[model samples]
Target: MRRNDHVILGQERSMSRCTRVWAKFFAFGALCAPLFPVPPAAAQTPAQGLTAAQMREDLAVLGQTWARKDRSFTPEGRERFELALRRTTTQVEGMHPHDFALEVARLAALSGNGHSAAHLPAMPSLPVRLWWFDDGLFVVSARADHAGLVGAKIERIGRASPEEALQRVSQFIPGNDAHRKVESTPFLTNPRALERAGISPGAETVALTVRDRSGTRRQVELHADAEPARGHTWEVLLPEAMDAPGRWVHVLDALQVRPAAFRSETDLEYEWLSSEPRVLYLRSNRIYSVDEVRLDLKLFEMTMKELVDSAPQAVIVDLRYNMGGNYLNTILFAQALPELVAAGGKVLVLTGPVTFSAALVTAAMLEMHGDERVLFMGEVMGDEPRFWAEGDLVQLPHSGIEVRYSDYFHDWGNPCREAACLWATRIFGPKRPISLAPDVRVPTTFADYARGADAVLTAALALALDADVGCAAQRVRGAQAARLATPAGRACVAR
Candidate 1:
């Protein structure tokens, strides 16, 4: 079913922080002009093929039924969503199921929100896992059957080169940044996505040209495998002594993180990643309570107390693995973060590609009020400002393809953001998200993974060296420590 990949919490050691992120991550793009690939006439099967009429009906229902019900699609995103559905319905008549699903994904992502997705019905992926990084796609993980190809750089998939394949896939990946392409492409490392994009000739297998880790070039006869359902994790690293080793994982990539069981996130956990410059690390793996842990609403106040009492050199809150259970988690934290900034601590919010939804809201809130002391360093976030979100799943009666529609319109404090006309980005080939302007963009590459780099944390500490936390401690609080007030915080409040 179509989904804006809200991942189940899972564990994997990647770029080292023993990360506990929740989502299926990593993907690239493809080059399907018009978004729909032209399926060959002879490729159609009465059993698996969808008719233009059926597609038209689905599109009609999208506007007349689902959109009407999802109401979040109205006022701004409604017309654009309907127009995309209309165009795809006309184009889908002669397409096969995979191709049709591809178009549906694009139409859903066109809503310009991560919470809304046009997902194809679930299918098993190929045995090997393909990764998208700053350079391009690579084989990061493989089942024993295809173990020989692990770490190979994928250059082509069947008929199309990697660049072409990624462009075609990009349109359907929800979110408006290059980071979304990387986070979403792993789900498409299958034969169907390739065939549907007109990049592969069939549904069962595809020819993958890859440059092996040793620099040898080869074509892998990759075949479909019943991919196991992925799992999630919620873990916490206890506070460490000032000179203790960091909890960051130096080995393993994203998929390699396999925590056997979940951990309790009922309380907030803080650690000291470094003592030389004194970086206090806080990991917020989940936003709400789960069966395994006690959900603590006062955790934010406790964290603030900890920050004030300990008086560390800098505060690093790790929200990369946080998959949003409560927006209130963000609200509470946002209300108090200015204290850290006011205390002259360098506050670095360490985020990853999967930092999403309520977690994004939290980050946005911190930035909105966290003053100059705050600096974000990592990949572009999973969601964006002015996007459709808070959704429910809907399935088509005929195709059974599931789609998630937005339930609410979130402003994220950006009045200039217009969700209806949002343009999603794909970092495939030359077209990248020009708007993904992180203060410091760190690359989580395979090479970086191999060297066991906690790139985000590393970037943070490195940035800390340049910051003068000492000078600010001299009590120049009122004059030099003023925050850059966002439009949301600038206006007068009514009693």
Candidate 2:
């Protein structure tokens, strides 16, 4: 599904310098002299190869350090921080580092607060991002060469498969008792497990086994290569690349959304080529857009209206490379779908972890509208609580460590009777604190889809075509199919 616009959540909008804590988190690879494989040290080197205990201690200390600081919120900041905290703590305890980081991103997203983020280490190799759908992995985007795996199931990565790997890594990471998709990654995309398993970029040839649409199994060998360069092209930055597999994939994604003339509108020579009829598929290279000076919402609205108007069914919303922007805008844009708002054509939304904040809101709203008759394909990031915050930062004058505080709160549970009062006075809202709850949860993971795994997407496509309703059920990824097929594998194959 193509998104119509980008919206900033809460309208409480808000970037950045490095501190010692930032350095420690980033340079952890070099700081491991006596942490894990070794011991603690006094020489001032940071720790690496952290165990579960160590990671817990580190997070706790980080929190305590913030609390001890003598900082006060500017009423608004206090409300923002508290609301953010409430929103954050709801999911924080069990989140893996990446998931935790994403939550931090969401908090930061509330105020556009740059200081609030889960620190990450710089990693090479363009990562393969996954979207969870009904416990199945659906590839959202990745570097080129690995495009074939976009719709393939990640039954195996190297010698170990998905289940085995997730279990082993869970010990060191923190997350809810639910799924352990990419959203659950504690740091550096399961740095501990990947390192322990000895996964390396040099291992270009990876073995993959996935089930086909007919329930037959096939084995494929993928050559992991860096995405090729497409000059200094805007399309180059597109979620997929502009060349090779990406070029074709972009065209495919756009076609799925809607067939329109995609042309560039710059006086300067731009490589962004339009499909026919002005359906513009902006390439994903960086977050910066060619129209660098326009309000994101207007641009999105204008473009979407143009494409959708050309052909009602011709519109296909592609967020494959869309990381995230104004979360609120994401939802408002979906309003443009006339079919979705129609009496019975339920909205068909494709979401994943990459779809955060406003994007998540859009999905939720479409689902909520009921009129949109919206159902989602692909994998979802997970249900997140939405709350507004009045961001106020507490900076440790000495260490330059910054902590965020909320000055206000917003709750979805506020009764309509006091809509105005609740909007103005509620932070936790004295009721159910959960912000947004996913009606249907999809467990998208990175390895399976990032490598071009496609069973889930195919399933979604089938649903879209069939207009199947009430298909929502607990998601179990490969486990479900594997179990269902156990008897068939035993009897039919033998027969």
Candidate 3:
């Protein structure tokens, strides 16, 4: 999209508590606190069961709210939802609250939009935290009592193989396959989720088959915590940041150095990687602006000015850990990049399963505006380019679980023209098609992670170093011409 001036009618809703907690857990790479603290008396009291009528009423409200507000809702999704509802209604009398919540979550996932979900209450989790690496699912962290399990590869959970468990758990997550993988980590740690997914019997303890670094295979029984652990949709912790001392022990705690990508905790940060080549590295951990966090417009402007002044031959924008915020904050930054590095330079965007929502939008914007110079490297993004977002949450009456719905549509696969753009004109202008696939795909492997190596960053840096820095003659043709037709385009060409 090319626009000189832009206006946004409204701000995106703040990250839901579930999302916020996930962001914190991943960003900090440690267990901080319980998601929702319960009073001592409340913790001691058992959960009151709900009647079939109350559960049905909650489901009805959830369906009605989604039908009314979610613009992305489709006939196929609605039909499937109704069918599931009918089947579940008949069985609610015998179902537990946790099982009912999973059913509701599965209903929300039917929309196929990442933002749509049923945010269930925190559930008890096994002491160990598992992460899916390129090789397989492995334990990255564990409560002090189960520290021996850390770094062991998971072969099976109860009777189900790791692959089968992942497939079963995928039903409760929304969005594309990539997003499902990103959001399934926390759910995999929950014993209730494991039981619902048919990976284990509903019990306080679950058996796991694991192989340690020594290559010895053994079955380990893990018990769930007494208190419910806070869970979020996205929870990938950086291996290097596992050093923070807490109730949990991380496998990589002995490592002394943190990789460049995990070095900063700020929402936005930039530094010069090489003075001779004039390579600049910018990492945006979050997309929103909050003055209290030093992630405001002023910081953004200053960063952009430095980028322009540096005249870097190559720039790397890392969004692997960004779960999203306000994409509008980076519109001007995206628009200015094509010309900024058009002359024999490159713009590299790093994305992964956690690069979602507004973070995905930022990468799309870079690809749309920077054209051929913009290279995407790393794993697939959390969501598809064309997806639904910008909505609010509705809490179910009896269960109190929050179900989120999407009210706006954003298409990066096709240009946004006239009515195709659902939001107000003030918020967006004519947008161009953006391809989200990586030019170079680099998956993070457990071997690299265990040793404190960043294969993705290494590959991107190598590509940047090998790239030719001369402007192509055909730069002003087709899409380039269309971009150059605008004032920003003319300015870019003049530079």
Candidate 4:
């Protein structure tokens, strides 16, 4: 999903610098060399605490780099960063060593670029794993010692409510929209960030208020995990693979969690939601991980062709699980989707908070293509067509904290969303990003989350099942007239 520095050697050579910042570069086209890959070269985190001088040095370098190269940087974001840096440095100068990295990290987040973030060094955390669902934040899982916390609705951590804590932690996260932060909150809600941000008084213990399934609300105290803490994974430290597995899916499918999207063993999966009229369901999790064994243009083409040939009553493509990959793959897939439309099968594209990056582009391409047969449903996109992406990592010297920043403007050929127009304002400028708003805003409320409900997909199929196939194009696209249909009736027509 990332463009390596070698991308500068190919079609990207038209520019004077590297194209993408996703450092986890893969071999695609001319980008043969992986630049800034961090797995092998991790510096040992220091055993001792950091001094104010070291923190200051890190901020200086980070600010300079971001101000110089961040594609989404703006005067407002810069002003906020400078103010936060000045105010926070003075506080960190005398604060505990535990708070140093978080303090500086929050300042980096002031840049407001989704590709840019202040990464925290690995540290001990509470045992429970939390995640945000449409209902609210809840404990998804926890160590054996804290197993009871699972399924409890998270009301507060430390002194702040789950919502309040998320707001504070979001200052250090570079997200284009609220959904981005909402989808990623659990991963970022560690003890280090909580303590440093003053949500928790000390790192040793945390206080929480949660509601059990019975709706009983009470306070609970849990000690942080022990020292020699497990190191952070590449997904946590970097921006590229933020599609780390989450439990909200299981929570949505309360009875038995079905394997679909990223949770599935395979990247591509298809099934029949119903028999009569035949509602087909398909999900492509990640652009790069499509085949499980090997994902390339050929595999994608085959999958699309197969899907179209099935000739179901309707087709539901679940992209909610897709965390992005090669954008070109979307174009390739689009080329083959007309067959499904021509076959009189309606198309419903499902999205959610996790739908991001290249995925957003794919959704935009389908929407902008003006296809009458296609429609989008679910949460608004996490990223946008007009966004700063292809980020490069800049690690701080003292703390080994990684700072990612966008270096390229991904313009989806939209005039109003061009880089120049986006950056030309004091309001709604680059710092204040934009994302695609879905046509049908479907929410997966917990009460309706049957093991196989697939709420969004279910909702789309409900709207589509009774509609005339010939009207699919005009219905969603707002065309003056419905698209033409074949002499053969919509049902019983061989695809």
TM-score per candidate, chains pooled: 0.67, 0.42, 0.80, 0.73
lDDT of 2 at 152: 48
Q: Give the Cα-based TM-score of candidate 3 against the true structure.
A: 0.80
Ranking by lDDT: 3, 4, 1, 2
* 1-495: candidate 1 lDDT, tens digit per residue: 111111222221122221111111210111211111111111112237567778777667666666665644445666787777767766775677666666667777665666676655555567666556667776655654566776788887888777778777676776666445654454457577677667788778878888987899988786776543122211111111225332222114332321111122422455444434445556665665444322333343344344555556676666766656555434546656656543566778766666776676667666666656677777777666556555566776566666777655555544333444222211111121123236777766667554334556556655554533322221111111122132321221100
Q: What residue runs in model 1 are displaced by over 4 Å at the alpha carbon?
A: 1-59, 69-100, 228-269, 275-278, 292-298, 301-305, 321-323, 413-437, 465-495
Provide the lowest-lDDT 10-residue window in model 3. 34-43
lDDT of 2 by residue, 1-495 (tens): 233222221131221122233333434323322110100011111223333444444434434554333132235754665566555554445444433333333333233322232223222222343333444543344445555545545565445565555555443332222323433332212333344444422233545465533455677654533432222111221343345444433313432221111122221111111122121222221122234322233324343444444542222233322333333222334445534232333344555544433344445444444332555555543223333333334432322223354333333333223432323224212243222343344443333333333334334433433422212111112112332145433332222
Output the number of the lDDT-best candidate: 3
For all candidates in order, the CA lDDT equals 0.53, 0.34, 0.67, 0.55
Q: Which segments of model 2 are wrong by more than 4 Å? A: 1-61, 64-117, 123-180, 184-323, 328-343, 369-372, 386-495
Candidate 1 vs. truth: CA RMSD? 14.7
Write down the worst ten-residue block by lDDT for model 2: 34-43
Better of 3 and 4 by TM-score: 3
